[model samples]
Target: MYTYIARQAIFDRNKHVHAYELLFRDGESNCYPAHITPDEATSRLLTNSHLSQGLEDITQGKPAFINFFQDTLLHRFPTFLAPEKIVVELLEDLDVNEQLLDACKQIKQNGYRLALDDYDFDLKWQVILPYVDIIKINVSMFSQQEITERTPALKNMPIKLVAEKVETYEQFQFCLELGYDYFQGYFFTYPEVIRNKSLPSSKLNLLELINVSSAKELDFNYLNSIFERDVTLTYRLLRFINDPLLNKSNQITSLKHALTFMGELEIKKFIALLALANLSDNKPGELLKLCLIRAKFCELVSAAKREYNNPPMGFLAGLLSMLDSLLDQPMSVLVNKLPISDELKMALSGEPGNLFNYLQLVRALERAQWQLVTDYAKLLQLDELLVFQLHHQALLWGNHIHLASQSK
Candidate 1:
């Protein structure tokens, strides 16, 4: 709930970043704000969330679940783990100096690998020559003349030279010719793009069952038919049903049991939201962050607006609004697959609804687009001064999440 930060370690040829080691094995990812000891990085400069959590987590105390990234690597990894723990970048335009030597020595002593990031070699920057274990060169920044000039000099170096920002397959092949190791960019995502494929009949059956579950009368046979179609989707469906964040008061024994109370449309939207969240895994980090923002706004706005009347559909509408962006396809493509209400559909497509206005307001707030945010706030009948207050509150929540992820 509080905030923290995670640092992106810069690297060179001689050094590299290894995996983040936190105190607890993060359930899904270890590339987080690896727990650390502030005293360990006593000399390093910090800003944003990292400095806040690193200092506080060290001075105040640590729970069993939390550990500093630095501390985690030093304690658990040791030996070859240093390489995975630190980013070894091939730094560009940096000259060799005491500062360079001191940092390299310090990093190496900490059992972390170093890499030169965005490497561009210069006659004067030879100071990084001996210390770099890995070199990262940005191929995108070079002209043909520059490539021809710099390529030959770096040919036979013992250090592993990694070429980054290889956007296309052709560019990747060219970089391979120039001897780049270990790519780190969106090229892999582009290659893995999901093409047009019709939804499986089993999925269709499950969706139909969920539609039936939402009727005034509960249909047990249709609900059972859902699992008979896709049992795996049912497991995720159950998890969504029971997640504390979703405000479930009790554990769900089964998907059918969840349906007894939450109803068909609610179950369908929750399932769809989970699918969208999973789909966002391969996209840009910005895309994932945007999804999180939309998810939060949906939950909060729905809870606020639905006070006079129950409308979980508002939550569904807000989350589904970003479905296109998440799937890298048009919203209309798969929107028809679900049996959402006409009001929810109108809300999603920006026609007009309680959920749509709130979503539009959130988009404006995110851009810091003052005029639109103001106009929306006025229409929502929220006080003008109070609008900024809520905006700032949302920003703080975002900042808190930003810091906590860094905390690991």
Candidate 2:
């Protein structure tokens, strides 16, 4: 009895992550079970996932857009979740009658944001439109001209428009121009390659630091020199070592002492974090946050198995997974310069292996591809519930790291 859940990020007009739509599945079937009513699916999700482990753990403090059928709304299931933390999404197929309309009014009065999912602008929905806060439109269902014509009416209303199933940069730009308040899709994961864009020397040095730190053996003198040369790196390293979450008994005053305390594993992770924060300066912060989540999630999964020859490589592989998007270079080229192990290189290069399976499992969970998530989890010999729990832990850890980086 594993509780299956996955979230898809929603980005604002500026491409920053705004919220996540939490998708719930009853089983490895990857969708709502045909036998169970939508009402039952929402109930189980609330009881098993939301009630047991607060929503903040899974959503990293972002508001979750969760679907609700007419019955669930009338039953006040939305009341179980925190109003500020969730947006009650009314399914498009819901009957728009007096009872449902009264329920919608009460829900709005209760302080919960309301979203109309897969809205098609029918006159029947107009009766309840005044109570809605957001309207989600499936961009794939309409032509650009149709969208342009249909959207102007929404623009004048207080409601926000969310462009759903947006799959490419061009689509995002068009929607942006059309005044879409938010977007939902995989467009941000694709790299926007700028031809002949050279890596800055400072970033190259950071890459060198990442390469050196990930080595099989620590080069203490070499690492010390690199830290000594860059004051910002030294400051961040010390600050990371002293983060209250790490729980240091005594404050470390020197770089050598900090390295010694962290040993090889923590030092490697720190360097990776430093490089990630520095490299992703110009990109959306969500990319860095995703990398941290993947890194921590992969590390936790491999460490749980206890059968892999080297589990630390799992973290490195996950951390480097987004180098192509961050550096605007192909993964093959980036892996060549990193000096990581062949196994890690193979995994990051999309070749099949234990680490590759781990990366795939994280990705599948991220994209709500439950069958692929089940397949990769089976290949890795991990329990489904454990994977979900580990993903929750990773989200919390990533949120902490993301906040720490921002504060500095």
Best by TM-score: 2
Model 1 bad stretches (over 4 Å): 1-96, 121-125, 143-223, 239-251, 260-269, 273-294, 301-329, 336-408
Per-residue alpha-carbon lDDT of candidate 2 for residues 261-315, written as tens digits (9 for 90 to 100):
7667787788778878888887878889899999999999988997453328888
lDDT of 2 at 128: 90
Alpha-carbon deviation at 135 in model 2, angstroms: 1.1
Backbone Cα, N, C clashes tallied per candidate: 58, 0
Off by over 4 Å in 2: 27-35, 51-53, 307-311
Candidate 1 lDDT over 1-408, as tens digits, reads 122222121122222322221211111122132453442332122222243344323212211111223332233322322233234332343345575566566656665556666775656546656665666677788875687668777767777666666565466566666656555433432333345755555445544653553244445676566566666666766665665645448788886677667766566545545454445444444344444445555555555544322336545555566655555445565556656677767776677766678788777655445567658777877654554444434444433332322221
Global lDDT of each candidate: 0.49, 0.85
RMSD in Å for all candidates: 10.6, 2.1
lDDT of 1 at 18: 25
Residue 97 error, candidate 2, Å: 2.5
- Where does candidate 2 clash, by residue pair? none
